[model samples]
Target chain A: MLSPAYLAVAAALLLALGPALPAFAGRPIIAGKPAPSEAAATARWLTAQNTWGFLSTISSDLSGAPFGNVVSYSDGVPGESHGIPYFYLTTLDPTARDALEDQRTSFTLSEFPLGTCGKIDPENPTCAKLTLTGKLKLVDLQSSEADLAKSALFTKHPEMKDWPKNHHFQILKLEIENIFLIDWFGGPKPISPTEYLEYGKNQALLKLS
Target chain B: MLSPAYLAVAAALLLALGPALPAFAGRPIIAGKPAPSEAAATARWLTAQNTWGFLSTISSDLSGAPFGNVVSYSDGVPGESHGIPYFYLTTLDPTARDALEDQRTSFTLSEFPLGTCGKIDPENPTCAKLTLTGKLKLVDLQSSEADLAKSALFTKHPEMKDWPKNHHFQILKLEIENIFLIDWFGGPKPISPTEYLEYGKNQALLKLS
Candidate 1:
């Protein structure tokens, strides 16, 4: 014989935690961050938690110097994370422009901005940093994959939807070829693209989240 | 007569606001951030406030692909920013190793992490983003400049001082040649390195802060 208030609270909790519900434009519910020992889990967790990252590309404007720019990104819309980060970029900016000229790029994310580092210095290995290196490829706006990627990105970054159309903001993603993750002291963890992209598919990570 | 409690409060406020005091490793007392219209002032302000950034360098190990790494940095002791970023890095990391091979590098900082952007998106031009492109040079430990840089770093990141001795962490600084600042709409503001470094020196920015 539970009180009505308690019953209502339980119902809300169930809806929030239920995985079957179609999660939309909101942050995903990560039950708790995975242990540092779980490299793939940690990498996926970092990507899921952060909304923006520093993107590096070979500069066409600066005689091949490495250029880093801060930009917003999303891996998925809430509970349905695909682990492939999608970005809304405009060619007016050098990041998108550089990618057009030379696709070689790296997207770096840090745990510090997530406020989970807990006073640990960002450079500390334990603080966790993930750099996904590969090619930055543009997504065809007419494709269904583009529709999914745009949904994933816009849900995480709602303002992107209202950006001026003249800027020709396009969808782009990192085709991760090499993963460089430093979550602990020994050195960078070697995580293959398959291990990272297919992380949650086996259901091993669902429980942790 | 003023109460002792009130007097103590006043004295503490004065000490915090005093520009003459030698600020050590702690968050700077920026009375307030400069207006976005002030390009040099805004660039210096962003640099002074952030303690860490994403560093991009040409990867010698990854076939000259651009690599970005999260690293802690300091421009000066709290309130006294010199507009040049200093880093404590070990060659064990690809960033430092890459810097040795190719001096070209870019250090990027975002105002979003400072929590001043409010409900605005991180990619919003009003939120501010800065990139300093130049050569990453290792500092001579014996040089007096290293002593100052280390003090600036250790105070902001005290954990760096106790880092394992075997790692051989060395001090490095970015010799800035180009400045890219986006604090408002319409695109990046042009700011010369000299104007950025001399921002506070002329005392034009002190009043704003």
Candidate 2:
């Protein structure tokens, strides 16, 4: 084993090499992830950790084809996740336009980008993926829930605050009805929407304390 | 200006650091991405570089809700791309099953994960995102095109070959109808599927020479 003096020198070297480290080294403050075995917790962790995912809606433009668009979202502010993803979208984009015409949608996230699945193929079941299917509903700007959503979104995606005001960006959220989580080799984990949303309420409280 | 000797020393230092360098520094051989100004080229680049994306289909299980699932795909082997995304999907997954019932689908990809969009919020228009909407069609196993797809899929996603044979994985290709690409601040760049598929044909031929 190395002596204390040697360890101290190595630590100093690492500190001096700041900004040269890999980007993944400085992960954003994630609202803790759950063990793979905890289906509800795992599903919630995906919602909290991922900053962007594909949001799908039945497209009126494409004669009712399912259109998936890359979108940024937040479940809550860091370490205080509520397991419901909120998006800032504009009808100028097809996804929002489609949602207005057809509320049915799904938001899909993968753990591959989280940098935890080293050397594993992203398609591999062990890497984990989540699909939350539900209605994509607009949040009324005047509602208290919209206030919470705005705070959650702005904190995670600071750039959203400065998007062109004329674009009429509105807050939209998925009223999750079904949760499909694949965290292991077997089939999808059975996670009801309610179980997923409530999985870490106490833990989040503990973290805040 | 630094002396030649000084520059050589700096280069040596970087080489010695090896794994300490940022992971993006070691990007896989990408079919060179076109300038952001080349809308069709940029859209094709997104498809050629990304290994996985969100495939959205009309979900039969969820009462025709648009379902987005994370899936692995390939447009071609490294340095050679045809701009058609091929997926090895199993009906055991909802996405494939959904596609069988309703072929209308869209595959979405983002450049943020490719590590090219440094410090850009994923939702930012400059970061680049693509959505290919089309019919997801199965390639018959007996067709010569299936052989080409298999080669492309195996080269990029080797683990696919090892997946359980009993899982009934089949090759599926998106017959792209529309292309939505956002690479700059303006808006989605309008690109026809034909323009996207043919954008780099001449460049690809020149490279082969």
- Runs in model 1 deviating more than 4 A are A1-31, A204-209, B1-31, B204-209
lDDT per residue (tens digit) for residues A1-209 in model 2: 44445534654564466545321121221234555556776777677778999899888888988888889999888878888899999888889999888888899999999887666678777678999999899999999999999999999888677676777899999999988899765589898887887776666433321
Interface Cα RMSD, each model:
12.1, 9.7
lDDT of each candidate versus the true structure: 0.83, 0.79
lDDT of 1 at B84: 91
Candidate 2 residue lDDT tens string, B106-201? 999999899887666788776789999999999999999999999999999886776767778999999999988987655888898889888877
Error of 1 at A61 (Å): 0.9
Best by TM-score: 1
Model 2: CAPRI class: acceptable
Worst 10 residues of 1 chain B by lDDT: B21-30
Best by DockQ: 1
Clashes counted in candidate 1 amount to 1
TM-score of each: 0.84, 0.82
Error of 1 at B185 (Å): 0.5
